[model samples]
Target: MMDEPNPPVWPDSVIIVHDTEDADTMKQKLEPTQDSWNAEHNTFTCDYHFSDRRYAVLFTPGIYRNVDLEVGYYVQVAGLGVTPNHVQFKGDGKGPHVPSLNRHIHKNSGTCLDTFWRSGENFSCANDMVWAVSQASPLRRVHCQKDLYLHDKDAYASGGHIANAVVDGHTHFGGQQQYLSRNVHFGKGASGGAWSMVYVGCGDNAPPNSATNTTITKTRVRVEKPYIAVYDDDKTKFQLRIPLVNDGTTDNLPQVTGDNEESRDFRHVKVATASESTRAIQKALDEGKDVVLTPGIYYLDQSLDVHKDNQVVLGLGLATLVSPVGSPCIRVAPGTAGVRIAGVMLEAPAVDPAKRKSTESHWSLLEYGCEGQTQADDPKNPGALFDIFCRVGGGGDADKRHWINIDSMVRIHSSHVIGDNLWLWRADHAELNPGESPNCPNVSPVFYQTEKDEYNVDTGIVVTGDNVTIYGLAVEHTSKHQTIWKGENGAVYFYQCEFPYDVDTDFGKAGYRGYFIGNSVKAHSLNSPGIYSNFRNATVQVETAIQHPDSPEIEVVNPFTVHLDNNGIIASVINGRGPAAQKQGVPSRV
Candidate 1:
């Protein structure tokens, strides 16, 4: 068996700097990223730093006792999953909703509990995490340059106050501090965690209190940094290389339509009998015609393989291409480059929430007779051995049904785009599959080895386009899901989008990103590395966590470097772990 990853070990190191004197002004808050949803526990707070303007990592209850603890504690873990402390909501489709997890008020909310990381001492954060406005309580009164705000999910995320927020007219945090994207939210066990290679920037064009305008000025800044590297030998965590972006660029982006819409015949197309739009679209492709979709639902499922060059499939002005519920929805495999898939509802089916297990409640096992390996050697979270429970033949169908095997959904974890937009509705398979896709039941944690030559009905969407722009979309409820966007595809711009019930954390092992880049189970950039481009002004919500096969365990596997403003939650970056030890495993540095 592969050895578990060792925790990082380093003399507690701290970086300190101080800068003062700046003028700043604030702009009107235009929109909210998130609206209404279920409520959860776990208190999360962020502190900004200004010395060098770096974002400090998140601090959890695990590290609360050691609040003044220094940074740079070496850690080795067996199955550690990462997450954004909290995120803002930004779902499009015209509406207002409430924030989940009684955030603004802690009166009724109990103590917070996170199952992922175990903290020994307080690791400090003077700068990394970003702050956001709770929907119920939008107005925040800041009195200091670097102040503290509270975001309690149970309180509708309302009520904003600046606890210690005034130093100068210009209000901002230090560079070394950590921040979270305002457009995402975390599940129950995920508030106050730390991650690496993520980016956090101050509000665009916002100035310090000193300045009259809150726009980007002379000293306005954000930060991006990497954490520990996962070692393959005995899973030793190590350091990684950080490539600097050269600033001497001058290449104009290629137009989406390529100088002229390349007239090419569309191949392998089908349409709904109820709508002639499909036939019209098919006709355009047959004659190398460019098909533009009006805002309408064209119900049809056909394998979309564009072998010809210069294919432009534009769904203009709220144009949505809905995925078929029962059958495999849409299959897109672009043979050439510059394949555009914009403004469409790409999704599978969702099992009725009422029919399924309570999303707010964790699965309980009373079958004490069964014995097996477990995430908690402690009895706080008890289950039959098989229920912590092991099942013959990999948990089989029983384990995966409720879980919605993320087999095929929308997978865009492949390319990069400057402008990326997606709107979707998610549904589950005829049956639920709990341990199927989330990596919870995965023993070794490997990608699906199934050959594409053999058609799998559930495959979703995979993307790798750059300079992508997305706007006005609502995506939710999928099973055996794939992804909205998948790999190394960089520079995405999303406007008003959502991810409600479109996920599973599974074992917290196999990576499940609503918007993730493909970085198999290898978390090393030096020996084996993963890559990402960038995303700006995006929104995500309700991507709940599932049973991780390596849960309660910790591992420092290869982590995907997600550098963004507002993104990702529930599950953060996960390290590697082993079957032998997954319960309450603390991370130790090598």
Candidate 2:
């Protein structure tokens, strides 16, 4: 056996299991009388619950056989390995078969328990290990040779976040608001009953709220057959973006898509300057051709309207589209479908920081589906955005810095708009020289620092359209809500957000949340499997993480007092021991 790396210094609450002897020793430490009793078989079970206590179970690298482990509130089960496959759990049991000695049969309905099973290196399991766990309990980095069921066969499960793992058999999620990220592969099974890599809400009496909100990001499928096959319900609030390529090569297995070129095709355009570039782009769009902008700075006096369907506007090598004062850079007309905007940087007109008291508002750099009434029929082909970067500041002069004070960086009114790797930034640090005409003006450096809130942009993204999906969205330092989703059935994969560090009092003492889901509408979902935020001011830290109720699996690191509002209920507090809290970081407030 490979020597195990030095174990992490766990908190006093964690239980370390090194061998079979350690498992027995720890069982006594938790209260032997509390052990589960199986009256049907008249046998004593090994399932132990710490009740209100919060703890973690760390297993060293080894092969553990027939160990039926169930955790309770604030309990974490982790293996010490470089990847998940290092620690192996083997048994002869299959399906819902639990060892007679120490097994806890999973129930379908009850108060959801918050538990976690993860690995540092690689973890693998031979039998169907996790047969009974709720949405609160997550299993991570476990390669299962046999099927690894999440919830009971008959009952509907709730919420969980599974990351970086693979299962040879079908992996079922009979719950709602579940997130699967990073290389989760499902094996290709027989073509008969439920032959899908990932199964969502597949129970007969599944809850009405179950299986509606699910997100799969950067995941892969090993089978040649169709990856996800939904049954018994409409996969309405679902998002599948940036999937790893499944090339038909035995050696390659699951090949990751190389550069942006491999993902889509585009017609390359090299322009000497900004003049007539708009007309040239319009002509190309009119012909139903995708466009690729070569490396250059292009200025747009008027918005480049995308009226044609299935058009792609891709940029190469930091290609920039700059808008003049009070003009939007790009606009996607109504009824346009399959429109893609990628690898481009958008800049709004700069404003003098010295004029901080002005009530004038700036325009958004990009607007999509903002025209006409909402379509009742779902869009046949949705638009997509990949690696789009946007900035608001340009000019120099710390005191008189040039900035963009727009209502929002991006506005979406269309349905089924998917985004992968989007960054909407308000430049905190200046770049261009002062008094440089349009880009910069002579201003005092002190004014820039003292009037930081005055120079900041209002919001990052405002969505009014339905079925919009975003994968990696990072919006930093906006004055109001950094991202506001007024639309219904929206999905987000991973969001990295930070509140403005420089804001003093323009947005009240509570500051603002990184994202806000409108309370007027229901059925909007956000699966921020990995979300990180930090605030500068102490008073500004206490803001809601998200407004919607169905949002699940938000991992916040080193955050100042923040609240997670799921639907209308206050689901959890940042760094709290509730279902949303991380087990490793700062101690839970609960």
Q: How close is every model to the real structure, measured as TM-score?
A: 0.31, 0.49
lDDT of 1 by residue, 408-462 (tens): 3333322222121122222211211434453312311211211111112222333
Error of 1 at 35 (Å): 15
For each candidate, how many residue pairs have backbone atoms clashing (under 3 Å)?
209, 21
Candidate 2 lDDT by residue in tens digits, 1-590:
12112122223454555545555674564332122566775533423321223343555556776555543323445554434454676665231122222223333132222222111113567875453442223344457787655554434332343434566776655442233333355563211111011222122211222122222322211211001111112211111112322321222222211111122211122122233457766666666555545445577666777777655675533456886556568888877776767556787665655654455444788888764565322344567675566776634344444354666788888887776556787754343334533221222221132135534578889888887766546676777778888877776655545456555544434445556767665755444322223333333333344544434432222222222211121124332223433332222222
Worst 10 residues of 2 by lDDT: 223-232
